[model samples]
Target: MTSTNDSNKAAPRKSGPSRRGAMKTIAGAAAALVAAPYIRPASAAPTALRALMWEAYAVRDVIGAFEEKHKVKFAPTFFDGNSEAYNKLRVGGTKDFDLVQADGFWPSLYFREKLIRDMDYAKIPGTANYFPAFKPDAFPLLKDETSGVFFGVPFCWGSYGITYNVGEVPVEKAKSLELLFSPDYSGRLATNARFEENIALAGIMVAHRMGTIDKPRPDGKSFNPYKLTDEELDGVEKLLIEQKPLLLTRYQDAATLEQLLVSGAIVAAPEFAQVYRLMLEKKAKGELDITVDHTLKPKEGGLGWVDTWLISSGVTDAEKADICHAFIDTMIKPETMVQIGKASGCSTTIDIRLLSSAEDQVLYLMNRTDELRGMYMFDQPSSTEKWERVWSRVQAA
Candidate 1:
């Protein structure tokens, strides 16, 4: 934490010496100087507040004001999916990164494992006005213990739903997951490759058909699609395998999926709203001549996500934690949240007054809480290990 001016205090002190002593001392000092640069660093390295989150969540324009206000560099590392982000945090990423803007519920695992630290809401007051857009139950996920020590702060809430080129798929037919399997689009369809999300989509179809989301498994056991039971996963896996041949590519990130969509290689897939924006950007910049626009929440409701901003537990520096909290404080502010909603099609905590052609107020579910019954939010299942094993079979198939 010391300044660069405090680089070294080992400079030789001035002293009187005999001529021979002075010459010997000078020679020795010269030798020491010759080896000094190799042995010691000239100055302390400048520190940056590191953020690991999704694409567009850390856009250059979105966080520009916060970066300037904090007078700190925002060093961002993005992940395509929540699984990869959690895996990285599990594998020493917690030690390297200071901030993580990941799935809204994922912080629960980090809180249980102590991978992330308790947040002082006093430090992140922006979260105080968290509702009117966020679900009432969403705040409970922030607390892992009864003592009320919170681990994470909420950021954006959105869906991993369908996006298809305008002309290729009609707006009416695009509102269902059935398109992913329809032979009409075989070899022209693409979808998210993430195990939980892809499998969850299958569960969504099941939930849609039977009118039994509370009991997702075909065997009649109660199961949440986000946390599918073993039997539930089995059903979902079978469905995905049956549809596999129809898929053109399995993608983990929005960028790759966007490339496929804009190139007209695949007509549709489950992707974030940002991809729709990317396609427009690409078209305007001449990166792609094609225009991609339609996005749908499956008739059965899509898998919804709420990404949270958490400071790593390994963050020992108080100053660094302050910087992370400062960034968090800006996240829910009306100005930044609007920019986020514009770049990302997700709903932000505060209402976004300014509207762009690409943005819609309904995406955040602002006053449309009635529709929430259909959306499935992300959750780490109790039977995660078993579900992951089943996912392996789905992929191997």
Candidate 2:
């Protein structure tokens, strides 16, 4: 569901209005940031491009450049989680949106449900710029298994791993998921509010703790974090209930998580890559007395995802589809990728070739796939209802 990046120093901030500043300007005029559109010249009243994606895509640095280049306005509908985005497209039928973003396995589901259309890679020259690890073949879910048509273009990726205050939590202890459960760290921990990821992570921890990670479930199927048996889920539920009191809060947004870490409200949590990046930026700006870093590989593999851009099936107009392709290409451009990185604290999908700064390289895990190995990449849970029930009960408890 998330990935992490940690660095002692942050890359130099580029010259321009920061995303926060831009959002504030828009927010001052509008009641909702989600409905806010990129302010374009009054003389140029062209149709606005609509996107349903993460909050990152709504940032001015990510959307404004494309709007300027294509001479179009952008209206981004921000969703906190992938399922929330999928449900919106599924119900609204993409007529209101031209482009949609989903992570990991959702592309296949979208293709299967006819919610998204296959991409014309030739139209998206940016795909050619992707790193070797991100090539189409490496991601089976992005393509139709039978037709072999790719449905999405990846834009950013990282791990949902153990993030801790550098000096407060030693590296040796931080490298294991078990540390979160340790009493020593009790009352100094936190986690995301997403049910599926928390449940999946609990399943993963259970599997590893039982030394049954490589074994099959009672159903004789291979052990999958997302497909844990009810018995296994019971363990997960119990574990979460125990961890509930330990947490400072079940944070629901990146901003809250960033503030919690910077303020030292909590020592550590399983977090996305951008939180660490943002913390490093804060530290670089002398906003904190302590630094934040995350483990690349926790003993019990971390949760990870690669989010991609997809053209919705409702884009029936030829010109609209062309614009969609162009938008995808522009987003993946090396320069734009870095710009989005600055605003989103995420690494671009293409090769790390665009990053020259040592700090940037360290934050993006520059050209290395080793950290990705053994990670339980996010996937559709076998039983969403069950996972949701467990998570709700844990929260209430």
Candidate 3:
């Protein structure tokens, strides 16, 4: 679900992918399929895209519509988290999946490792509408520095940050990340058990406080909040140890965090905007009389995840590969994206202009995000083995 912005609007090409640059040709069939509105049923046999994805992302209606129009099938396999999916793809081998709906950081596993094939942007003409952050050359994960080939197309996105009960924590204090680890709130704090997320937030807060707040590492420099270096891990781990005394418990999903918040088992901790959306629905339904403050981000910035669509290296067949390209096109459509936003509270990457017409549930996402500022996408590190060792210690502690 790449985004469309009002900035530098390219002339509409009713035909197909723009002649913006010399495009690569992965497979001859890809050319016909992209310009093709629907794959002709008689000529080519149907192929199934073994989609490794999340339950929320692969909405039934959207999948059904795509399956019907293209005469293709989707064999979905859901994973609990990005880390697990990364392993499944790695262990199972790349060729097993036709496509994987993994977090944006998946470039660390796919592109660098050469587990996936370089994509033909020309095939997915809709990519011209993606956010600047999503475009090739924007990040290492999206494009290869050496070949300048794009390995992934951004699909869906969501923000992660501290959520606090306004009744318990003052708005002034709620804005700070320190509130999450504050002793004053000890025994009342809760966090997602996702190792990287908890540790990333801790690292950012410490770096911001210690005046080492250099994120969005320019020139492809090493210091990254999502994937810490040995030195950065030391700082991150120390902060986690400090916060463990304050954390009531660690959680697995939004529902668990929601129950913890509602039961008064916790007051403040890290959460996704999706969970915040749920709390709002509960408030409107009179299920609870509590106000939650999720907007006020850590002055340093927060982390987010942008899941993208990538084809496995094993998908060399022209027919199957074309299907993957067609699926990417369908995913970015404004109508299809709106449906995804409606089904999953996560933000849809579509034309920002369409935000006005979106439902309250969809518009609710705007307030919780600050993509232009104070937000960084989650990432897998270059030295993930090094990062994982530190992360394990943080979790064990």
TM-score between candidate 3 and the true structure: 0.79
Query: What clash pairs does model 2 have?
Result: 2-159, 2-160, 3-158, 3-159, 3-160, 3-273, 4-159, 4-273
1 or 2, which is superior by TM-score?
A: 2
Score every model by TM-score.
0.73, 0.84, 0.79
- The candidate with the higher TM-score, 2 or 3, is 2
TM-score of 2: 0.84
Tens digits of lDDT, candidate 3, 360-379 = 63444543333623466677
What is candidate 1's lDDT per residue for 1-397, written digit by digit as tens? 3654465555555586779898999999999998764353424332567778877777676577767777777788888767778888899988768888767467887878778887877887676566554533455667865767777777776677777887888877787788888899989998877777777788877655665665445546545577655555667878888888999888867668877886788998887666875566566678876666544467766777667889998776577778778788877777778777767756675545454233355434565533444566776655678778777887788
Residue 374 of model 1: what lDDT? Answer: 54
Candidate 2 deviant stretches above 4 angstroms:
1-46, 218-222
Model 1: lDDT of residue 379: 69
- Worst window of 10 by summed lDDT in candidate 3: 365-374
TM-score of candidate 1 to 2 decimals: 0.73
Q: How big is the RMSD of model 3?
A: 18.1
> Once superposed on the true structure, which residue ranges of model 3 sit more than 4 Å away at CA?
1-44, 128-141, 215-222, 227-231, 352-374, 382-397
Clashes per model (N, Cα, C within 3 A): 1, 8, 2
